[model samples]
Target: MSASSIPGRLRRMNKTQKLSVAGISAVAAAALSLSLVPGNADAETEPQAISGAPVIFASAAGASQAKTIQSSVIEQHSTAEQLIKASDSAKAKAVSKEKAKKAKAKAHAKEKAKAKKAASKRGKQGASRSESRTPVFSNNLDGWIKESLSIMKAKGIPGTYDGLHRNIIRESSGNPKAINDWDVNAVNGVPSKGLLQIIKPTFDAYHVGGTPHDQYDPVANITASANYAADKYGSIDNVNSAY
Candidate 1:
């Protein structure tokens, strides 16, 4: 070989040896890192050399990248957790609001029911009072007799249907407009009129409260005459003949 070619060949041989050393050093570093891992103390770490090239160990860069990825993952997880918490809080608030709305509606329904019940009760009481105050009576002699009997009972005057009917038939034949124009009371300007045939002066003197003042009113005349009869003979039932 030439003297200059010998130096060039020696330089190439040194460069190849340096590359082989670098490849081996890289494989050793990879194995060391694997051994340093938490649960990989007994794990195998075999590195194959390809075409006698130096194995590049980018462990520091890979670790930096992994740390960045882990940070990003942690941040994503934290963000997800925060979103879940916010959603749960919103759901809870909605549930609470719905419950409050239902409670208010329930209370309103209860109050409405109570008011309806009270109104129904008041209506019933008012109907009962109306029934008591305004009784149904027929526009006839029997109805008048019964009505007078009712008034007599209220005024503490004693009489019966048979007694009042007999007296009314005897005196006026149940005629409310009957007038005793030829009687002593008629001559004295106070004629017996209406059913039970009571004179105006006598009717005025024995007029029961809550009855009409007119002697021609059948119920009023009957009530007043019965009052006089009750005062004289204890009850109209005791008088079978004219008073």
Candidate 2:
């Protein structure tokens, strides 16, 4: 029963009724006390009814009820506070994880940018090298003659740049594709061809290894003619006519 209702109800009741109500109140207070006790399962296991004559509740009863209510309120508040703290912790972890992810992504992007810059730098260097590089030689009669002389020097074949150039100018006017179709050699079915006007029989006989077989090919014709001259007249500078 409620504490405020007790006085009013007692005023309206006779002694017998008040006695009955007081006894019930005492039992209720006793049960509430037992219920308030923590870890009292064994007490609850064997239920017992309160049996006694009517008695007034002590001031301690009201104090006990107030304390129980205050304790419950305090426990609820503590539970809510704990829940809030736990939620804050979870949020903090999530924020930290997101920050870590963003940091890793930023680092990866930075590395990719650096790698791309390095590759671009290397490509620019490669282009600069290409631009700065020199040609081995031009694909022309003069280039062919100079290249042949180098090969001739390696093989111990005797020839000079000026001597070879003079012979080429006189024989074919330095034309790599020149042909003597009306010469005595041509009359005998061996037409002179190329920069040094080399006939087919002589070109084939003196053709150096590792050179093209086409007598009209400038390098091959000059090298073969030099070889023939070296063997026939001891040097190409000694040959002033068709040999």
Candidate 3:
């Protein structure tokens, strides 16, 4: 073959190779473009890549949702913590109020106890003072008998001094201001007054010629009761029961 003919043949082969490469490149570019497009029926139907774009986007969206959830959870946790703190504060306040109430009640109870004790002491003192006011007779029986007999004779009562003394001793243990206040005869509402436990009605009936204060006088009370007994029982010797 000729040298010029051989060179021309080589050039034609090279051109053919270039055209095949260009066609192959164009086909690859078209396939890539189709894959990039959002809506292409053929591309949509094709099997996805190993590192899938849709899967990557879904993962990214999930991550974003997770972040949003985390933010909401943090906010909820904060609100719950605030609520817990408020509840604790309320509990503390309630406990404090209860403690204060208990303390006040205890104080009131203590005051009541103190008042009761003080009242009991005052009652004892009053009882002691009342007991001290009771009369005590002297040991000189004969002298007292003579004086009492003289008084009874002056009162115009038909009685010997010895009988009157015996009667007085039996009735009052020789105590002119003796009082017999028993549950049966002495009604709860009415008070027994002075010597002989003279009820108000009986004393009013018998009070002959004396002041209101004379009812408390030992001599006057004895004379009046003696006179009354003499009138009722005929004589002091005739009387059996003392009261």
Candidate 4:
């Protein structure tokens, strides 16, 4: 081959080599572009630790709100519990007060019944004592007069038994049933009757308490009449004018 031909062939070869190098460079550049674009897209689209700031702030805010709600709920529950406790305490006190009131009422009823029973027993005993003493003064006028004289002597009255007996015998004729029919001073239409011819007013004034009858109780009538005569006239002799 001539030198010129050799140079041309060499030039063609160099040209071909350069063209291949350029094509390879272009393909590598396109591959690198594709890879870099995908990486950048992934970095933008995928979740990143730094990009989650808003979500983290939102979560923290929600947690704080939840804590506030929880605290409020706890406070409300505690208040409700306190109210329940107070209600229970008040109910217990009311129950205790009612029980005490019932007990007091029961005790008062029992005491009242006891007092009534005691009063009834005392009344019965007094009646029995009066009944037992009735026979001693039942039917004897002279003995009743003597008892009157004894009682007067015990009371320190200045009178002899004989003088008192004589005055009563003259006034009543020794009859406990003696009555006065001719007296002009009859009161309330009831005639003066019984021992000592005592008028109704005088008999009422001299009647003894708890006697069976005002005039029929010989000892009581005689003793009361004697005491009245002594007090009003200073002695039985002073009433002899009326007798």
Model 3 C-alpha lDDT versus the unseen true structure: 0.64
Q: Write the per-residue lDDT of candidate 4 for residues 91-156, one digit (tens) a residue.
A: 999999999999999999999999999999999999999999854533466677666666666665
lDDT by candidate, in order shown: 0.87, 0.87, 0.64, 0.68
- Give, for candidate 3, the lowest lDDT window spanning 10 residues: 48-57
Query: Model 2, 67-173: lDDT tens per residue?
Result: 99999999999999999999999999999999999999999999999999999999999998998883365688678878898889888889888879889999999
- lDDT tens digits by residue: candidate 3, 1-243: 988797687567777576665666665676687677876655454543332122223478899999999999999999999999999999999999999999999999999999999999999999999899744444344444554445667666656665666666666665645555674446664444454455555556655454243555555555565567778886666765644
Model 2 whole-model lDDT (C-alpha atoms): 0.87
State candidate 1's TM-score: 0.55
Show where candidate 1 strays beyond 4 Å: 1-80, 83-107, 110-138
For residue 96, give model 1's deviation from the true position in Å.
Answer: 4.6
Question: Arrange candidates by TM-score, highest first: which order?
Answer: 1, 2, 4, 3
Among these predictions, the greatest lDDT belongs to 2
Kindly indicate the candidate among 2 and 4 with the higher lDDT.
2
* TM-score, per-candidate, Cα-based: 0.55, 0.45, 0.38, 0.42
What is the C-alpha lDDT profile of model 1 across 1-243, one tens digit per residue? 889797787577777687776777777776677679988777776665456544456778899999999999999999999999999999999999999999999999999999999999999999999989987789898899889888887778898999999888998888899999997888998887898888878899999888789999888898999999989999888888868
RMSD of each: 12.5, 14.2, 18.8, 18.1
Q: Rank the candidate models, highest lDDT first.
A: 2, 1, 4, 3
